[model samples]
Structure formats: structure tokens, C-alpha cells
Target chain A: MTDQNGPQLTRIQQRNRERILEGALTAFSANGFRGATIDQIAEEAGLSKPNVLYYFGSKDEIHKTLLTALLDLWLAPMLSLDPDGEPLDEVLRYVSTKLDMSRDFPRESRLFAYEVLQGAPHLSEILGGRLRDLVDETVAVLTGWIDEGRLAKVDPHHLIFSIWALTQHYADFEVQVRAVLGPGHDPYAEAQVFLENLFRRMLAT
Target chain B: MTDQNGPQLTRIQQRNRERILEGALTAFSANGFRGATIDQIAEEAGLSKPNVLYYFGSKDEIHKTLLTALLDLWLAPMLSLDPDGEPLDEVLRYVSTKLDMSRDFPRESRLFAYEVLQGAPHLSEILGGRLRDLVDETVAVLTGWIDEGRLAKVDPHHLIFSIWALTQHYADFEVQVRAVLGPGHDPYAEAQVFLENLFRRMLAT
Candidate 1:
């Protein structure tokens, strides 16, 4: 997709815009939508306030862009759940990808978590449209698997919720997780094995 | 225990203090710690800022009191895990109580979620000491059950973490849960049955 100002933006402008977004992601994930400020985001980006504003127009624009981008990345794993693949294997692969995201992109997980916790005011429309559509499509595929006796009967939606809750827990609540697991504990490794055992038993037809 | 200023407070003072804490829970849960303010808390409590301050020295005092109280409540479910009872029953009962808390006290859940997401700055001490101790004791009981072949062999710590992750997700991400589940859906009712089935199969000896 071409940018609305495609022809006008120089290479430097595009680079600076990406820089500001990276900075905003860090600041917003740490401070939340209400707590984060434009000044703090500018400092994080290593750009002056004027420069930050010149690219993004306002703090809200920067935040909406960051969240929109993050949502796309977050949903890619689920969208990759192929109907042609073995049902349980496909679901487990999706789970693995989600856990990898938690490990590799914790800031993004917390940012989404914070938004959802705050009633999803910033992303309600997107949640209702894109997110809802994706989930509905996935649920249909899971339901078809169950109907063919390819997997055990269960609410596909709730199963999806469980996968999300279980994987994302390691990232969004890292402090509590680390405190409980103690120092030097590897949670992702344990989680991978545990969840596989769980879903295997759960999906055994 | 006496108040720092001595124990001469009237009944009204105690009631007013409780009101302030309740108000703070709503504000803090919605906006998180840094985003919330004394003026907002005071307004939510229907008290003047000076009056709210008179009862609690500062916003920090109010926050500390709220957190300490919530920690006690949060730990109560874990503390109720009985060693002498049927091991699986005890665990399921603990799950039920946690789900009940999520349904009844979602704000408390979000407040804790926010604190943990922010590295648990206000909760680190309690999480490290009180929470760690309780989990250790519970893990021992679970280990005992596994040793006796009364339950399936699993890492007791990871099992406990899964319980927390699964149960709390309903509360911490209520909006997303509701949105996906759609209108007229009773998530708690569905969750209760779903969890029971998952744990029953997982724990079958």
C-alpha cells in the first residue's frame, strides 16, 4: 500500500517516522496510553518535539499507528492457522508462534494488554471489525475439525482464549511470573511442554 | 492497631477511609497508578481533596492501603487450599474461588494486572515474600499428591501458574473476552465448565 503522501516523503522522512514509532512503542508500553506523554516519546525517539509532531501530527496519531501496526503483527500467528493442515498440529503451531511472540516482543504484548484492560477504547472499532472477523473465521475452522471428529468437541472460541491467555501471561505479567518462578527459571520452555501435553489430551479424538 | 496519629478516630472516620479506598480502586483500575490522581480519587469518593488527605496522608498512602488489602484478599484463595482434602478437589475449589473473584472483583484484578505489568513496583516485596511463601507451600502439597500417585505427574509450579493465567484472563481481559464471545454470552458459566473438563482430564491419574 502506498502512503497518502507517497511521492512527497523523502527517504529520511520515512526513516524518522519509523524511529518515532519505535520510541512511542517503548514509552507507551511502559507508561500506558493515559500515562505516556509526547515529550517523553520525543526524548525516546532522540528527536525534538517539533520534529516528532511534524511527522505524526499529534500524540494520538502516533499511538493509533503504533497500536494498528502491533495488532497486525499480533494477529499474524493466528491467521497462519491453516485449515489444510492437521487440526491439532495447526493449533499447536499457532500456540508456539504466540509463545515466541511473548518471548521476542514483550513490549508489544503489554501494550495490547494495557489497551484491552482499559475497555479497549483506543481499538474498539478494530476489535469489533478485524479482530472479530479473524476470530470468527478461525472458530469456523476449529468447529469444522470437531465436526469431522478430527479433534475433541470443545468451544473453539474459548480454546483460542485459553491459548492466548496462557501464552501472553508470560509476557504481560513477566514480573509476577519471574517472582513466582524465582531467578534463573526458564518459563517459555516449561510452558511449551506443558501446553503441548494439555492440548494433546484435550484434542485426542 | 492504632492509627499513626493514635486511635481516637470516630466511626465516621473509618467509614470515610473505606470510601476513599473504594474510590481509589475504581480510578486506579481504569487509569492505572501513574495515570490516576488524588483529585480524581477525591472526586470519585465524593470528598474534597483536603478531606481525603486528612484521612490519608497522601495519594501514596491511599494506594498502599488499597494494595495491602487487595493482596490479602487475593492470597486468601491460595491459602484455602487444604492438604488433607482430595488433592484434585482442593485444586478445583481453588480455581472456583479465583473465578468467583474475577467475576465479582474485576477492578481488583485489573489493578493487580496493571501493577504487575509495570514491573510490580508497589507489589514486589509482597510478591517476593508473602506470595512466594504461599506458592511454595501449595507446591509442596501438590508434590505430595503426585508422589502418592493420587494425581498425574506434572510440575506443580507450572500447574499453579497455568491456573492463574487461565482464570485471571477472563477478568483482566474482560472486554476482549466479551467482544469475542458476543452479546448474551455468559463467559463465567462457559469458563467454569471448560476449565473443569480441562483440569479433570489433565489430572486423571
Candidate 2:
């Protein structure tokens, strides 16, 4: 079977591919998939359009590759939700990891935000397949915790949605957050404490 | 003082302006402000480019007008949070109203989402001024509730943030929600119940 991770490449190929993706992310995140052009991406990458095309077949291909890589990294914390571990702790840890991702990778967060806001036309398949699988697995674990009386009973899907909404709000709505918070206000630090308290209150049996 | 809303128009001009705004919402919501063009909006509105320009001075004006109108409606629920009302009930009512807005005005929600995700270049002033003012007023009422032991104590700002995050998620990330919930799943109905339970639990004394 072909690897979902992508085919093997030489170090030079990998480096060039990384450069192209970096540029594409900037373009796509700023202008979105339709507004962004291959020429703009090549200029951002400091490569010729032909050279960029040599590494990735088309704009769609580059976007798919970037999305695949991003979703993998983005979903890592959720995927690591250990069924055998303390349920609330696993959930809280996932929250912290996701908050950190938003802080560290705001561009990636915006890229995904842009895609989803545009109805996720490009991501429906992956969302339906890979994302759904991961969520279903994690939801089963959360439901098991509730059944065992280890956590408060809540809709597993909505609980996960709450976590995502709360954490990603900081990144996806950064402008609104900052504007409302005013100058010099640190939102993420406040968010961490607030979210910890929120989930504790939300999940404690 | 010059009207921030718009100049007065004849009835026909007013009807045409409304049509333009409706079409602009669809175009801007679909492609974001930068990606969308006046020509596309004109075509969407079934107006000539010159006719579209006659109603609104420029593309920025159309976007600004749309955003201005949207924020007014968007903030209405928050503005209605009654200081004299039962605290938890007021909060839950606001939640329900916001969720209803999301379901009924998904395009408006996505338009705002697209702007905020791109750093709210057009909305920073309004967010800082009107939104912050309204939020501050609402927070004072919530703080009063907490002080009176009418509601569980929480960071008022983050509490507001949580409400916005959860309700707007149904609109902004609808594709992801629908994909995971599978075919024929009704997210908003389920979300209304889930959010009510969530806030009740979090806010219970």
C-alpha cells in the first residue's frame, strides 16, 4: 500500500518542498485557496513557478499536502488521548496542548479557519474520514469515562466541540480577541487558567 | 453629523442597495473580502458595475456597510443582557439567542469569521469601540451576579468568550461539525441542549 505520509524524497527535494509549503501557507492563509495564485506562491518561496510546480504538481496538490501535514500535527494531542489514563487529565492535557498549538501556530490555525469558513470544500473528505475516525475513538473513551463515573456525563461530541471552540477562538479570532482585550493584554495566559477552571467545573462528577 | 449608516436613498435606490448587500454577503462570505471583486458582486446582484458603484462608493464601502449592519444585529443579544434579570437565566437566554442567530444568519457569521480570521482589518475599530463597550457593560452585570452569589464565580471576560466560542462554532465550523456528526444529524438542536446543560453546570452555585 502507498504510504499516506507521502513518498520518499532526497534531502534537497525535501528542503525545496518545505520551502514551497512555507510560502504556500503564507499565501493561502492570507488570500485563501482561490484568491492565492501559483505565481504568488513561487515568488514567496523565492523559486520559479516551474521549479515550484516540479516539487508539487499544482496549487491543489500543495494545498492538499499542507492540509494533510497540518491535520496530522493538529490532531496529535487528541490522538494521544489514552483510553487507560485518567479521563479528566487526558482531556485537560489535550486542551493545554491545543492552546499551545494555537499560540505557536496561529497561521496554521488561520489557514484551517479560512478553509472551514469557506465550508471546507477541500477538507470534507478528510474531515469525514480521518477526523471523524479520531473523534469517534476519542468520544468513545470520553463516554466510557462518564459511564464509569470518572467524569461528569455530557454529550461526548459536544464536549469535544467545546474544547476546540474555546482553544481555537484565541487563534482563529485573534484580532477580535486582541481588539476587545486592548493593548498589552495577554489572552492565552488568561485562557489557560480560565479553561482549566471551566473544564474542572464542567467535568467533575 | 454625517450618518455612519449611509446616505438617504430613494425607495428604488434603497431596494437596489439591499439587493447589492445581499449579493455582496454571498460573494464576500464565499471568497472573503480580498478575494472577492466588485464585478463578481455586481454580477451576483444582477446589476451593472456602474450601478453597483452608484449604490456604494467602492468595494471597501460595501464590505464596511455589510460588517456594520452585521455587528449591529450580532451585538443586539449581548446588549439585551438585563442587569435586573435573574442572572443564570439571562446568561442562558443570551446563549440561546446567539445560537439562533448562528443558525439563521450563517452567511453573516461566515462573513464576520472571514474578516476576523484575516485579523479584522476592517473591524478593529468597531470591535474595540462598540463591542468592547457592550462587553464591558455585560461583564459588570455578570460580576454583580457573582458578587451576589446568584451565579458561580468565573472570569467574566472568559465566560463571555466561552459563550461566543461555543455558539459561533456551530456556524463558523459547520462543515467540520456536519462531517463528524454524519449525514442527517442536526447540530444546532443538539448544541442548544448541550450548551444549556454546559452553562447550567458551570454556573450553578
Candidate 3:
């Protein structure tokens, strides 16, 4: 999708952009940004190198585009935490939404993980600025709930960290998880049940 | 350290080997296996390229050596989860030890994270075999605790996953954590307090 000030991309152009971003997600997630080449991304996208370049100026641009979009998706669950909603219920809803995103968007989750793992060079500002502001708001919300005895008292920042860690593990560490658990188990479904119980037991007064 | 069956190397040989592995950890942790080269690892280790190869046959050998050591350290926490100890205390100790590892051995943590995130190509056998077996034993120990009314009723596997996800997050996502928290916070110390409370609350019968 074009920015409001930009001219509209043609339908085909939009599709190609989406395809490039999708393939770039695969490439970048599997290989760190430095390791992934433009040729590899184009190959993964089923497009020629020049074709990929024609759509995005360079690998960095493609990466920036993906990271920008991913940051928004990454923030959605935290952004949706309703201060007006029941405290425990709202937190659970946030956890559930994040877990669903991990299941539905494992590539995106790994992309975020990879970026952050490489020192978040592309994301440091957003991590400190946009993401921080939202977490600050969330911290306030959780603190208020805890102070009111509407939820069990816990450090708000660490609580947020815990949620991120628990949900993203399924996506970022799927191999170890699968290897450890062996075959024939539904990880996401089981994780949902386990996490819900764990959170409820942790947060319930 | 030399293999028990092998003749011991000189002290200088052992130190150089440790240097190479340490440097390899930094390189591999920052840039996944595909991205890191032996030259880069040599540079990180402060040794010449030929000097580096003199100790290890190749980059793959160096990476393998680092991971083999990492997996042992990784398993140390879980392996020490004593079956005969107080169930709650044993679980809490496991959490504390793991969190300590995340604090003290962050690079090792990220090195393992990178390997797993990249599908554990070199580690599939060990993951599916040794690590899985260790987790199986851990699951049995946890099940025994819960069944004996010594611990809360919870899925042993997911419980172990939670311990992993929660503790490892502090290390694997250190950049994001620091960015969001800003300056002046001793993250590991704060994490320890929060996680101790979290597990305590969640595990109390």
C-alpha cells in the first residue's frame, strides 16, 4: 500500500511488492540480513534480480519496508490492550492475540527476532521510541490494575517482556521445540492451553 | 578441554582453542552461521587466520565445537533439576540458575538461539536425541512432582518450555529489552526478581 502522499501503485505492482516482501521475509528470517543477498531474495520471490530492484531500490529498502510493516504488526497486540477493559481479561486477550500472530505469522515473528538479535540496527529507534511509548502506556495500565488490586502485583515492564518471550518462542525456536517435543503434537494449541493456565495462575489474585 | 580418551594438549594449545571458541561465539552469535567466516572469527579472537585454522580444521569445526559446548551448558540447568528435592524449590532453583545463565552467558545463549532459529542444521541429531531425552527425563521428573501433590498440575513439557522462553528472552532479545527499558536498569537483576515471583506464584500448590 502506498503512503497517503504517494501515487497509487498499480494492482500488479502492489502484488509484486507483496511478493517481494513475502520472499524477503523468508530470506531475511532464514539468513540474517547481512547473509541474505538480493539474488537470493529474487530467487525466493520467483522474480529476476533487476525486477526486484525495479520495485525496491535495494536490499536495504526491501528490508526497511518489511521491518516498517512488521513493527506495526508487532505492536498491534500491545496497542490493543484496553485500559477500560477488565484487567485480567484484557491481558489474556493481548496474550492470545500475540500467540495467534505467532501461529499465523511465524515468518514475521522470526524476522522480528532476527532483526532484534542483530542488535536491532534497523529497529533501535523504533524499539526505543514507538515501542517504548506503547510499553510505557501498557506499564501504566498494568500498574494501575495492580494498584487497584484488580490484578496480581508484578513488575509491569517484566510482565510485558514475559509475554513477548513466551509467545515468540514458538515461532523463533520452533526447531528446538519440535525436536524436544518429538512428532505428533500440536504445539500452538498446546501452548495456548499451557500459557493461558500459566498466565491466569500468575496474574489472578 | 581435551577429550578424556585423547592425549592432553599443552597449556598454550588449550588456551588458543578456548580463544578460538570464544571468538567464534561472538561472530556466530552476531551473524548466524551462514554469515560468519573463519576470518571474522579469527579477527574476533585476535589471532591470525592461519593460526585460527591451525587449531580448528575449518569454520564448521569451530561452529560445531562452540555449539557442542553450548548445548552442554544449556542442558546443565535442566539436568540439575533434581527429582528428589523439594518439588517447588527444585523448580525455583532451575528457574534461578537458567536466569543466571542468561545473564552471565548471553553470547552463549544467542549462539544457541541463532543455531536453533536457523533450523539447527548441525544440531538436529543432538536436539532430537540427547536434548529430547533430557527433556523427556525432565518431563518425567516434573510429572512425578505434580502427581505427588508436591507441585501444581501443569503440562510438564509446556512448563519446561515456559522456563526456557522466559529466561532465555532476557539474553536472546537483550537489545530490544535494553532499548525499551532505557538506561540505568540492571536488567538481569530486575528480571531475576520478576521471574522468581512469576514462577513462585504460578507453581505454588
TM-score per candidate, chains pooled = 0.96, 0.94, 0.96
Winner on TM-score between 2 and 3 is 3
Off-target runs (Cα >4 Å) in candidate 1 are A1-8, B1-8
Clash tally for model 3? 0
lDDT tens digits by residue: candidate 3, B1-205: 2353566788998888989998899889887787788889989888999999999998899998888876776788888887889998999899999999999888888898988888888899999999899999999999988988988888899999999999999999999999999999999999989998999888888
Query: What TM-score does each prediction get for chain A alone?
Result: 0.95, 0.92, 0.95
User: Model 3, retained fraction of real contacts?
Assistant: 0.88
Where does candidate 2 stray beyond 4 Å? Answer: A1-8, B1-7
| Model 3 vs truth, CA RMSD | 1.5
Model 3 global lDDT (CA atoms, 0 to 1): 0.89
Question: Which residue pairs in model 1 clash with each other?
Answer: none
Error of 1 at A88 (Å): 1.1
Worst 10 residues of 3 chain A by lDDT: A1-10
Answer with 1 or 3, whichever has the higher DockQ: 3
Candidate 2 per-residue lDDT, tens place, A1-205, comes to 2135566778888788889999999999877787689999999999999999999999899998888778877888898898999988989999999999999988798889888888787898989998999899988999999999999989999999999999999988988888887787789999999898889888999
Question: lDDT tens digits, residues B1-205, model 2?
Answer: 2135556767888788888999999999888987789999999999999999998999999999888877778788998888899998999999999999999998888898888887788888888998898888888999999999999989898899999999999999999999998988799999999999999989999
Residue B196 accuracy (lDDT) in model 2: 93
lDDT of 1 by residue, A131-150 (tens): 88899999999999999999
Q: List the residue pairs that clash in candidate 3.
A: none
